[model samples]
Target chain A: MNEYFSDLFSGAKSLLVGLSVTIREMFKPVVTVQYPREKLEITPNFRGHTELVKDPETGTHKCISCMMCQKECPSDCIRVKGEKREGVKGLALVSYSLDFTKCSLCGTCVEVCPTAALEYSQEYELAGYSSDEFRFDLLKRLEER
Target chain B: MTPEAAKQDKHTFVLNMGPQHPSTHGVMRVILEMDGEHILEPEPVLGYGHRIQEKMGEARPWPGFMPNTSRMDYLSAMIYNHGYVSLIERMTGIEVPRRAEFIRVITDELNRIQSHLLWLGAFLLDLGAFTPIMYTFDDREQILDILEDVTGSRLTYCYHRVGGVARDIDEKFVERTRAFIARLRSRFKPIYYDLVTSNIIFIKRVKDVVSFTPELARRYGLTGPPLRSTGISYDIRKNEPYSIYPEFDFEVPVGTKGDCLEVYNIRVAEMEQSLRIIEQALDRLPEGPFRNKIPRKVKLPQGDATFSVETARGELTYYLVSDGSDVPYRLKIRVPSFSNLSVLQELCRNMLLSDLVMSLGTLDLVIPEIDR
Candidate 1:
C-alpha cells in the first residue's frame, strides 16, 4: 500500500511535468506540416547535383565534348566521345553519357567546365531500373523540358 | 637523501578497456592506469581498425567518391550523405532544387531520429538497462523501413548527389514516412520517459555525474547533441542555416547541467526538434527538377576549400584541394567523434572504471569517425 501510493504520486508528478511542457509546445505552433497538402521553399544555395545547362542565346549547350568532365570525374560516371570536325576549329561532342549508378554528384565536372554550360539545376530525382537506364545521354539532358 | 626521494612512489594498474569491449561501442582501445577501481591515468589507444578513407578520396573522382563518406559513420549515413553532397555543391557552386532540399530535410531528420533512438538504447544498455534496447528497436524498425523504401539500402544510404538527391519521392513513400514519424513520436516519447527517465536507478546513476562544463565543451570542439545540452544554442542547421532550415520553426534545447542526464535530455529534445524541422520541410516541399543541370565531362579548377555540415554526431568538416585534376590533391576530414573523444580523458580520470562505460556511451563515440 505504501509503495503503491508513492508510485501513484510520482506518476502524477511525472505526468504534470511532461504534459505541461508538451501543452506549452502545443500553443507555440506546430513544427511539422501535412506535407502533401503543402510544400516547402528550398534555399537558393541548396546543393543537389550536376546537370547540363542550356545556352540562352543559341538554344544549345557549349559542350563541344573536350572530355574535361570525363577526365575530372572522380567516379568515372561520365563517358564521352569527341572528334575533330572539318569546319569547327574545336573538338565537337559526338556523345556524352553519365552513369547515375556510380555518380557521386561532386560537381568536379561542372566546376571544371570553361564554357560555363554545365550548371547545377537543383533537379534531384534520378532513380532508374538498371545501369543502362541510369546512363543519361546529352540529348535528353540538354533538350529536356 | 636518495632513499628519501625514492619514497615518492605511486602504484599504477594498467587496464585494457576496449577494441572488443562492450562499452567502447566499436573497436576503441583505451589503456587505463588505475589505483584499484579508480582510473589514475587513461591513455587512449587509437588505430585498432583505421579505415584509410582520405587516401581513398584522393584516388576516386569527386562524384563517384561520395560512397566512402557514408561508410565512415555508419549510423547516420543519410546525414553523412547530406554533408558530403553539401560540400560538393558548395565547392562547385550548384544549388539543389526546392523539392530536393525538402526530401533531404525529411530523410536527414529520419536519420537523426534513427541515430538518437540508437543512442538512447545504447546509453541505457551502458547503464545496465536491457529492456529499453528492445523498445528502441521496435520504434527503429519503422524508421528503417521508411529509409530502406526510398534509398534501397538500410544502413549506408548514398541518397544525396553533389548536385541534388538521387531519387524522387512517390506518394506512398511520403505517406509512410509521415505515418511512421507520428507513430514513433507517440510511442518512443512515452516509453523513454516512463521506462528510463522515471526510473530512480537511472536518475541516480546519471544525474549530477560526469558533468561537462560549457567551457570544456567548446575547448574540446564538441558539437551536435552534447554541445547543445551544455546551455549552448548552437545548431548548424539553425546557426548556419543549410538547405531549407531557415523556414523551419524549432527550438534548440539547452541543459543547465552537462551530465549524462543532460545529454539524454538534449537528445530527446533534439528528436522533437528534428521532427519539427521535418514537418516544416514537408509542408513547404516544392515541385520541380529533382536534380540540378550540370553537364557531363566535369573538372574543378585548382582550389583549396573547406566544407562543414552538421552531422548527427557533430560538426563534420571536409577540406578538399584540387590541382585542376580529376582527383583531389588532398582530402582531409575533421570528424566529430575524434574531437569529442578528447574530452573523455578528462571525464573518466579519477572516476570508477565502471562509470567510464556510461561516460563513453553518453558521449556516443563512433570509432571509425574518430580514427578516420
Candidate 2:
C-alpha cells in the first residue's frame, strides 16, 4: 500500500511538470500569423497556379501557338485552339484554356516549353462557386497582368 | 518427459508482420518469434513490391527516363530529381548555369526540409505524441506552396531535367522561399525542443531504446542521417561534391551515442544545415538559361553507372545494367531502408513490441522505396 502511494505521487509529479512547461509556453510570444488582417509574406519561389506568359514586345501573348505544351501536360489540364492564320507566319493561338479541376500542377508543360512563354504563377486562391470560373482561359490571364 | 518439455519451450511463436501491415510503411514483412510479449528473433522479409527502377534509366534515355526514378522514393522525390539531373549533366560534361544550380540547390534544400518535417510528424505519430504532426505539417504546407510555385508540384515533385531545370524561377519564388526558411528555422527548433527533446516522456520512450554502434552502422552500408548519428561525417553532397554543393557552406551533424534519440538529433541538425545551404545558394544565385542545350534524342554511351543519393531516410543507390539497348539489361535498387532493416535482427533481441515499432519508426522507413 505504501509503495502504491509513492508511485501515485511520482505520476502526479510528472503530470505537474508537463503542465508547468505548457503553461509557461502559453505566456511566450505567439507565433501565429493572422491571415486577412495580417498577411504573412510568402517566398519568391512559391508555386501557385499556371499562367500563359505574355511578350512585352507586341503587347500580346507569346505562346507561339505551339501544341507541344498541350501534348506534354501530364494532367491534360491545358486545352489549346491554335491555327495558322493567313497573314501570321507562325501558328496563332485561338484560345488556351486550363481546367483547374483536372490540373495536378506537375509542371511538365512549363519544362517542355521552348519559347519560355508559360510559367507557373503564385495565385493559388482560385476557389470559386461556379464551375466555369475554374476553366481559366489564357486570354483572361493576359488582361490581368 | 522432461526432455520433451524442454524442446517445446525452445519452440517460440513466430508472427509474420507482413507485406501489408499498416505500420510496415512498404511491403516489408518481419517474421517475429516471441516468448510471450518479448520478441525472441526477428527476420525482415523483403522484395514483395519490387519495381525495376534502375533498368528504366537505360530504356528511356539519360534525362528522358528521369521522371520514372522519382516514384521510387516519393517523400524525397526532388532529391532523386537532383541525382538524375546532376548525373546526366556530369556525363555530358555540361557546365550547369549559375542560376540553375542555385535554384536547384534551394529547391533540393526545401525538399529536404519538407521531407524531414513529414518524417518528424510521422515519427512522433508512431510514438503516440500526436500534436507535433499538425505543427510540422503547417510548416510543410508552406514548403509545398513554395515548391508548387516554382516546380509546380507538392508531394512527388518531378522538377529537374537533364541539362538543367525546365523553367527559371521568378523574383517572387526566391523571396517566398527565403521568408519560409526564416520562419521555419525559428519556429521549428523550438517546437522540436519542447515537444520531443524537453519532454521526459518522449526522451524516456526514445533514449537508448534501440542502440546502433558506429562499427555496425558502417558494415550495413548506412549513409545519410542514421550514419551521421553514429558519429560518421559522410555526406554524398559533401564527399562527392556534385552540382554546386562544394560552393555552399554547411556542417554535417554527428551524434555522440548511437541510439534512437541520437538519430533524431542528427536529422534536426541536418535540417538546420540544409537551411544554411539554401541561404548561401540563394545569395550566390545568378541569371542565365535554366535548361542546358541538349538534343531531344539523348543517346548515352554504352556503359553502366551505379548512383547513390542521400535521401531523407538514408543512402538510396540505383545500379543500372545497360546492354547497349534502349532498355536496361537489369536494374537494381539498394534502398537505405533495406540495409537499415538488417540491423533490426540485432536491435529487437531483448525489446518489447512497442520498442520494435519505435525503433522502426525512428528509421523513417519508406515501404515502396524499400520494396522497389
Best by TM-score: 2
Worst 10 residues of 2 chain B by lDDT: B55-64
lDDT of 2 at A103: 70
* Model 2, span B1-372: residue lDDT tens: 232343477855778887787567667888887766677777888778776655545444344455566687788888877776665554445567777888788888888888888888888887887777777887888888878666656666778876677668889888998898788878754666755666666776789987777888878776667778788888888776767788878998888787889988888888899999988887878877887787655544466666777777767666665566534555566777778777788878857877888888878888777766
* lDDT (10s digit) by residue, model 2, range A1-145: 9978876776566556656655766787776777769876654455556788877888877788778877766556788888988998788888889988877565667767888888777675676888888888977777877
Q: Which candidate ranks first by DockQ, i.e. highest?
A: 2
Across all candidates, what is each one's fraction of true contacts kept? Answer: 0.18, 0.18
Error of 1 at A56 (Å): 41
Candidate 1 whole-model C-alpha lDDT, 0 to 1: 0.77
Docking class of 1: incorrect
Cα lDDT tens digits for candidate 1, A1-145: 9988887777677656555545554575544457668765543333455567777887877887777788777677888887998997688777778877777655557766888767655554556676687677865777774
Interface RMSD (C-alpha) of each candidate?
A: 9.0, 4.4
Query: In model 1, what lDDT does residue B338 have?
Result: 88
TM-scores for candidates 1 onward, in order:
0.73, 0.76
Off by over 4 Å in 2: A1-145, B1-11, B321-331
Error of 2 at A37 (Å): 21
Worst 10 residues of 1 chain B by lDDT: B1-10
